[model samples]
Target chain A: MKKIFDFIDLNAEIQWVIVIILIILITATLTFQIWKKVKPSNLVDEMMLRTKSWWGMCFIFLFASLVHPIVTYLGLAFLSFFTLREIYTLLKLRDSDRTVLLACYLSIPFQYYFAFQGWYTMFLIFIPVFLFIIIPFLLVLSGDTTDIISSMCILPTSLMLGVFGISHLGLLISFPEMNTGNISGKALLLFLIFITEANDIMQFICGKIFGKHKILPNVSPNKTWEGFIGGVICSMIIGYFMGFLTPLETLPLILISACIAILGFMGDAIISAVKRDFGVKDMSDVIPGHGGYLDRIDSLSTTSSPFFHLIYFLLLA
Target chain B: MKKLILTLIYTVFWRSFNKIIIGLKYHNHKSLRKKKQFILIANHNSHMDTMAIMSAMPSKYIHRVHPIAASDFFGGTKLNKFLMKYLVNAILIPRKKANSDKDIDPIEVISKLLNKGRSVILYPEGSRGTPGVMSNFKKGIGYLIQKHPEIDVIPVYLDGIYKTLPKGTSIILPYNCNIIFGKKIDFHSLEIDDIVLKSEESIQKLIKRE
Candidate 1:
């Protein structure tokens, strides 16, 4: 692996990963096409739309990853902004909450800016600490306490998850030590993304095939114990093989992959419960088949921070 | 040159703001570009309504599209008048001068625009009202369509713009807004009252859909 990395040039791992991703997307598209021809149904049509969206997403991911780090930061920041917007829209926040909502949006750029500047202390505490107090203060300034408790709870938590949580991925790129030969922070970022997405697909496939016993019937009816276990194990295996992408050892990588898989499921379940409570099937139809930015990045939003911290403790510390 | 600047602004700034900041969505709008000259009637709730409608049009027709605005409201200040005239390309008509013989008739201005193969965006509700609630569309639209029987009338349903920039608010919040264009209705044989009622019904039906 080191020989191949040395032979190709800098960013070889990232290039190889992009190539692999493209191949996977093309395979998925071809498989969907063949499957549709063999068995045409609403399910197939939906799957085809999903695969088409994946193609678009892959192209974007490739562009953002291969381009300048500033582009990746901007893309991540915009994603955070849109997901937060989607959450705010669903919460049906009052007009009085507009100041707090704008505050929430204004915090997104600063959060990502902290990450970009490698101010880990500021990035970690910005939204959860400072904005937590300031948001409620702004809400109180409005003096409309009719549903103050709900806004108080929803605004901070949404900002924490949608903005603070996702900005960690951008922070990964700023790690100076992660830039070594063909292995850079981009590879690590892509590794986490690929594993999280793979785990989602694995769990979904396992659930459809072997999902009999419900894991959480109230929160996510489709989730099953069998699917969860199968997905984690599969992700662990994939993570072990892809351990070269990161600086971690095999055992830690496998364990961390399992943690990510479990956390991803939890993330999906949490968002699912939010949707269920709101009586919404999807967050929004921004993405053609993936529902919304929030719907697509729910798992990533949850898994990113934990993954970043684990790597930080193991390698950086 | 002013028309060119308007199209440039619409294409660059206004379109991005609508799509990115406000998250505007369109439904059944494929045929909107094919429309050469038509009257677009939509529900008014926000100051963003006219800009949103104009931004959604093809840049080729953007210079030719004029949103009819009440002079008293939009022409209150010199700055607002400049923006309404130059930026928005709106035809400001006096709402209180219906009986005045001196001023050009509001319907006549709209008819002249339509006669010259230009499109006009008319809010049948006349003014911004309660958010998410539809009031009775005034008979002005019915009268305008009656004069230009050859022009097609497209009923548009705008949802969630009020949430973004509702009445009595200058702060623009980010929200998902929808613009649904309905099929063109020909009211050649229908009575003016029927046209008014049918146009309202058409927009109301669009609101109930999804």
Candidate 2:
């Protein structure tokens, strides 16, 4: 406890950043609530409730960040469980794919276990390579070759993004703090979370205000060019100041911020496409305001892996 | 004491076991809870199907639900009868026979239960069928609804239960199984044959969602 406080005292700037972000979020919620009263719109109510849920999520995340890396890893494992559960609940799974689904769900614990051990090679290749082969073998052994093509394609795709992709956040937190006066893994995880979440919020706010051109109307109707540009710029500015949380210099931080924004946008669209294909309005109504774990962390699904790789090669290498 | 123990076993022990092995997904069209005495018919595939329905049912309705099991299969011995009567809360009726005098009619037993404001779960297919293919519903369901036209018949589709624990298999395989409840059908104006066909049709429609 004392050590955590001393670490907080040392990284007081990051502490201040969290406080400031919380204040801004609260102020935005209040302003939106008032705006909702003057002009009652369904969109405003959804946005207001979404903002409220964000406050709850942030506090939970802040507590996790303050705790040990094990807490962060377990928290992420829990997140992966919820996300995969939602995916399974909505996915059009075949009878033969049942074993494959079980294997996929079981792999969540193994993936996090690898992350806990800091077994990077196992963590990275387990789902994409090993499960990629194992899932089909299990399917074939079931002796039902019907819908094999679609099942093979969809199972691996869902497992990769839904389970393995989200597990990278836990892997990111397994990195050891270096000797060059760097922050701990929890701080880096928190930084990635803040940037990605802020980017999403900023994009929503900007799109609502000045969103005329539909970027991909078929895939994601709400995404707009104006919103995307505004969000990227704002997140870049925020990410530039957050550079102190990592060992990156000015140029790398800006580049990382841009990567998060763009890749995060792509992630959001990919999930939206899947949801649209599935004819589901939301993944599941598990969370009160946010639809599901998938809905809340769609951007993180895309951003986490690339962001981790960028930092790994640029600084850790 | 029996109802309490059965409810506990179903809720705690069977539910968790089946839930882990066969991931059950439920899609209820309307609030089936409010209807106290409707006939619940599902495509039978495994012994677990009745247990799945028992677990998914609201606890208040647990005691009221009497799943109709085969007398020969479940009531062959005194101990089996005790288990069926107590643990399963089952109404053991004889399987279909050509002679009506020797065998007690299942409709009479089911109607008696329904008149007492108790829900009865019927497997219209008589016994578990092959996993994917649904068999023709027996005329018993139509006759039950015909005799007691006031009762609403709810159709249920049980998906993937055959593969989970098919007949002649003691080992339970972990598979993704779903139980979907279709809308309640009113047989007041329909013929008995139409009632059976429509009831089968409603259940067949739910399989499409799978």
Candidate 3:
């Protein structure tokens, strides 16, 4: 045991610094949780729950980074499973939705399998070409044989939001231009989540304080024009600072952050529409004072699905 | 254990939000609050009837409540899987009857949940029958109460379930089912063979509204 500890990299200075900083942060968070003003809230509670998830996610990603890049990607794929589960729960699915549901469920494991095997072409084809084309017909199989709307809308909507829209996050594995930064994709994954979540919290706080005019009360009542305006500005600033801290370039980072926040709101809105129709609160109650599986990932369900591909298309292409 | 808690929490959120729109009620809730550890038999009028019993029960009891969902229907789909795993905490048992000589039985599972300090909800008159009328119950309740003499065999009627979301309707109608808890049956005096007959008679008597 002594010899095992000896060969271990006990001499790494950076590891010690990371350990100390993490200890301090954990201590502070526990102290805040105990003494901070804990109120029953629709919004603030959502913010803290998300922040806890971010901490958990960071540890998972960092831990995975030690093993292999494929393992890190697999860890991310598991995250996608729960995230997709959340999205699937929010939307209503007809019996015909099963084939596509199978396809959508199959996409995560398959994409990660590609990332695991280092098969870039199959991974790229799986979501866009395969999932995009197949899901709509899976809707048709629902045999709404006469009325095209249910087959058209419900089936395609879930797969696009669940599968096709978010395929590009996996595409990051082979993304060539991004390699120049040398920051692991897991780090970028963490970065995306942090900025997106921070934007959500800031928007809620800004909206609560200064919100007067409703942005689209029909779709989402809690959202406001002021909140949207304030959230984007704060997100851009936060993204800029993050870019500087990571030593990544500036203008693009700010633009990406703004994009995540704006798109995150759209995702939140779509999920809200689902809950409203179902007459249910939060997707499920997995978290204390929070709703179900879907509620936790409404943003990712909406944002990442589309955002990943858009980034690959715009930047990589 | 984690699955049960998650289901209870999921159901609580759903009930709170659904109550805002569905508009449901339970009469004489105070008498029903104190009781625990029972084989609850209820009329299966609609899907909402299940939700009514779930929402009306206290959270602690709700945690212990295991609805005996039919495997053919409840186990067959992803949505049902989510609901069974994370919303209802339901125990899906096969509905098919065992052969005459077969030793393996479905009652064994129900008997187990009762032993583990949990209450089991069994719709004795299997299948969602027509709303507002009593369907003929099978001998399963009689068989169960006879076998597990310790568990309280409580009779419950979901008063408004027929209209809440009536049978054969695909869409969930905007209606609330009110649950009425009748008296619990005492089987301490009965013999082994007499147990089945007595329990069946007791359930019939309790189903009648005064």
**Candidate with best TM-score:** 1
Question: What shift in Å separates residue B18 of candidate 1 from its native position after superposition?
Answer: 1.2
Q: Provide the TM-score of chain B versus the true chain B for each model in turn.
A: 0.94, 0.91, 0.80
Task: Score chain A of each prediction against the true chain A by TM-score and list the results.
Answer: 0.95, 0.92, 0.74
Model 2 earns a TM-score of 0.77
Task: Estimate the TM-score of every prediction.
Answer: 0.94, 0.77, 0.58
| Residue pairs in candidate 2 whose N, alpha carbon or C atoms collide under 3 angstroms | none
Model 3 agreement with the true structure over A229-316: per-residue lDDT tens digits: 8999999997776562233467777878888899888877888888888777675545554465456556766666455555555555
Question: Which one wins on lDDT?
Answer: 1
Question: After aligning candidate 1 to the native by TM-score, how far in Å is the CA of B110 from where it should be?
Answer: 2.8
In order, the Cα lDDT scores of the candidates are 0.86, 0.79, 0.64
TM-score order, best first, reads 1, 2, 3
Query: lDDT tens string, model 1, B7-76?
Result: 7888678878889988888687778878788889999999888778887888776888899999888899
Cα error of candidate 3 at position B84, Å: 23
Categorize the docking of model 1. Answer: medium
